[model samples]
Target: MYKNSIKILGAYGTKAKGFGTTSFMLNRHTVIDAGNLLDALAEDSLHIENIYLTHSHLDHISDIAYIIDNYFCKRSKTLNIIGLPQTIQALKEHFLNDIIWPDFSKIPLENSDVIAVKYSELYLNEEYHLDKQTTLTPVRTDHTVPSCGYIYKVNNAGVLITADTFSLENIINTVNNDMQIKSLVVECSFSSNMQTLAEVSKHLTPKLLFQALKKLKRDDITLYINHIKPSCLEEISTEIEAFRGNFKPIILKDGDFITF
Candidate 1:
């Protein structure tokens, strides 16, 4: 098995006093999303070289703004913000526009002519080599916007992170085809009682999550559950415990670490 560490910086669907929104770090240099990154990494946030975004949602991309602004003078190299073309477009037009935040992509860094931030567009189902041992591939996911999930491969082993997705067909297919996938990190945003809101928002409840897990062919893989809405945590936890499945799902929280 390929040995690589995935550190959970923030795993909740929404931010509360103790719970933070979704974000994770691959090894140390690469961050999966921007949510709560500044708070989680603190001064070590400067070490982040690349950020592979799962989508353009605020909860998933919120810390990108702060990272750039807070570390503006400290960073020497351009921070690579990567995601699907639509995700990058949304960030450019809506979030990082000059009206809301300074367009750091265009502005030069302090004491340097090079820009502080750069955006890289990734295509679905295509693998991009991060290094000799790491690669990232984007997969389509059902969400309110043009969103997608990420398959992060380290050496021969892989981990699937389904960021804020409702549909599971693509996720199941990805797992079924790739025997190297050792773990899955999926979102369950609400409890069974909020099925209507979950369906409307294109998120998953405990009931919906179990229904999707029935399609997964793997039985040995570690199943990690994330993105539980803070307000419904108790109900969602109870609902998840009530549902029986082949794999026991572990509710992920901030600072949780997974090695595969």
Candidate 2:
């Protein structure tokens, strides 16, 4: 069997040095989030057909504005925006409304097909089929807003992306319950010193993240860390390196790809 690789279109914690925000273009056409995607992809941005959003945060949904405007002429089909009900409602009421941005769902394409930005509600822990060989399940997480972590299965390999979570119980249970889960991408958004702000913002500092991971039973998972705040990259990296555990977390930078 051929291994499917995941490409990182944008992975910086912040938009420093002309780098975009945290957006992952999975397997070319499918995107997990849209932060900086329009800035990252430029003219070829019309190829994206599906976006599985984790939440309604600005950093996660910012590029939806540009993608609709810049590629409306080139898009041949509807762009499916898949997420939870709250996520969909939030985007519709706040971001994609005509006041903030044009309602692309009603806009007509050249071929008479309207630009479709429809929402599909994903239930907790239930696996939804994306294609013949790919499935994704949404696991609820403790964020300031309604958020979820994704369990993406492709070609028999499972990768869990804990998107902007602060809860330990959900993470522990998901890790212990899913045996097929081989790789993980978790967020550590702040240093240990920023614990108060991190908790208030419902984000995870290195201290909080490690304490949460202590509940997990797995000892043999390839852990990848992401979402480190740009201001605290130095402190966060040092804190993460000092972590003593069975699995050492790998921090991701801009344009890093992973194959498992």
* TM-score list, all predictions: 0.97, 0.94
Runs of candidate 2 with Cα error greater than 4 angstroms are 1-3
Candidate 2: residue 29 Cα off by (Å) = 1.8
Please give me the total number of clashing residue pairs in predicted model 1: 0
Deviation in angstroms for 213 in model 1? 1.0
Name the regions of candidate 1 deviating beyond 4 angstroms.
1-3
Report the C-alpha lDDT of model 1 over 1-260, residue by residue, as the tens digit.
12487889999988889888899898567889989888888999988878999888999989899998998888887889999899999999999999889888999889567798899998999988878998888999999998888888888898899999899899999899899999999999988888999999999998888988898888878999999888998999889998845568889989998777
Tens digits of per-residue lDDT for model 2 on 1-260? 13355666666556666666677777557888887787677776888888988999987888888887777777787888989889999988998889999887677777546655766677788888778888888888889999988888886688888878788588778879888888888888888888888889888887788877888788878888887777788888889877735667888876677666
* CA lDDT of every candidate: 0.88, 0.79
What C-alpha lDDT does candidate 1 achieve relative to the native structure?
0.88
- In model 1, how large is the Cα lDDT of residue 152? 84
- Output the lDDT of residue 111, model 2: 58
